[model samples]
Target: MSVSSSLTGRTLIVMPAFNEEEAVGNVVREVKKTLPGTVVLVVDDGSRDATSAVAREAGALVATLPFNLGVGGAMRVGFRYALENGFDNVVQVDSDGQHDPAGVPALLEALDSADLVMGARFAGEGDYRVRGPRQWAMKVFATILSRTSRTRLTDTTSGFRASGPRAVALFAEHYPAEYLGDTIEALVIASRSGLVIRQIPVAMRPRAGGVPSHNPFKAAAYLGRASMALVFAFIRPKSIYRTGSNA
Candidate 1:
């Protein structure tokens, strides 16, 4: 897909940080390097470390949350900020530096035709292998999401994505609040609300610093909660978030 320069300055890159002090600065710098003039906002999810300071020093805006809200909650805050601040687009990137900044252009370019564009690691040209219980859980969740939403998505739990105004508004109001929630549940919400969702292939790197957010040990618990969220998403009535509703 050809990338357009229209959303360059208007887009807001939302990076949710949780004790990612070591990686936040570099991540912010990398995003700015990839997408010049784009606004990078780091949502400090009640980090005990210097994540906020580091992000701010790295030439990005920072919104420090009062307490830890996990990835979903932090992303909701970023969405709200984007909505209130008059951004035309929003991209979700992990602060741990696992998500490739170079993919932001593809996601933004895909956003021209899609309300939401997911940077899928597994669906891409190269192989991004997942092993153990986490892999099993991801496959199961992907199957459930694809079957229910009727959209074939290879990476259901991927955090790398870009959202147009329609999706940003919807998610800002009622995003998922569960532990392993945001990415999958938000897609379901977007699909139910009549927004177009698409996925593009993107490469992912290992976390630069801090521990991986989800591991095999937590896979069982994540699967349970995520299953419940998926079920509720399907059962819940569709409510489209209209443009300018929040204005």
Candidate 2:
């Protein structure tokens, strides 16, 4: 689906960038090409590099943070922008060029019914290559989250995702402020809120330049911490969805 035809309401592509000056421009350019009418927002997470300038030159709206905010914090800023600006949809893609811009159409298509559309590298029919250990960890984490949420989720750690207005509001209101665990937390929150979550297969590439933020040991630790966090969130007797006045 072409961006113009698929999206009647406004859509914003939010790129949380940290020192990705090398790839930020290209990523923004590709997103513009794929989703012509969509606005692009690059949340600069206090990078010492030229990531913000490059993104601006590429025609993306740059939101610069004074200091380093992790991925979740950056995304929260983007989500708040989307909400305050009245965007109907928000799509998040990494600035490292690991996520293919071409697959954005698949996500937009899946958003037809779902409140959130997630790209699953493992479940989709595509050439997805990940380190063996990281792949195993993702699978295990997905299994645990699915059982805990009472909803099957194929990719709980995927950063490539699209969110509709409801999700935008949800995230803007209650997004986790630290780390990269918001992907799974969003899913669990959506399920509990009775919002529909869908997944599609999208091709993924290996990191284009620097190594991933998490190494094997770090990935394991993040997985463990994220699992515990999800369990705690699920057990807490609180609804992420607000009541009538707030909604």
Which candidate's TM-score is highest? 1
lDDT of 1 by residue, 1-247 (tens): 3344567778889999989999999999998888778899999999999999999999999999999998899998998999999998999999998888878888888877889888888985556797866677789877876765677888888889999988888888877767666877787888777788888899888889987777768766766777777777677656434444532
Q: Write the per-residue lDDT of candidate 2 for residues 83-197, one digit (tens) a residue.
A: 9998988889999899988888778778888888888888856777666555776788788767755657778888999988888888887766645447766677667776788
How does each model score on TM-score?
0.91, 0.89
Point out the worst 10-residue segment of candidate 2 by lDDT.
238-247
Clashing pairs in 1: none
Candidate 1: residue 143 Cα off by (Å): 2.9
Clashes of each: 0, 0
What ranges in model 2 sit over 4 Å off? 5-9, 129-133, 147-151, 240-247
What C-alpha lDDT values do all the predictions have? 0.83, 0.79
Model 2 local distance difference test score: 0.79
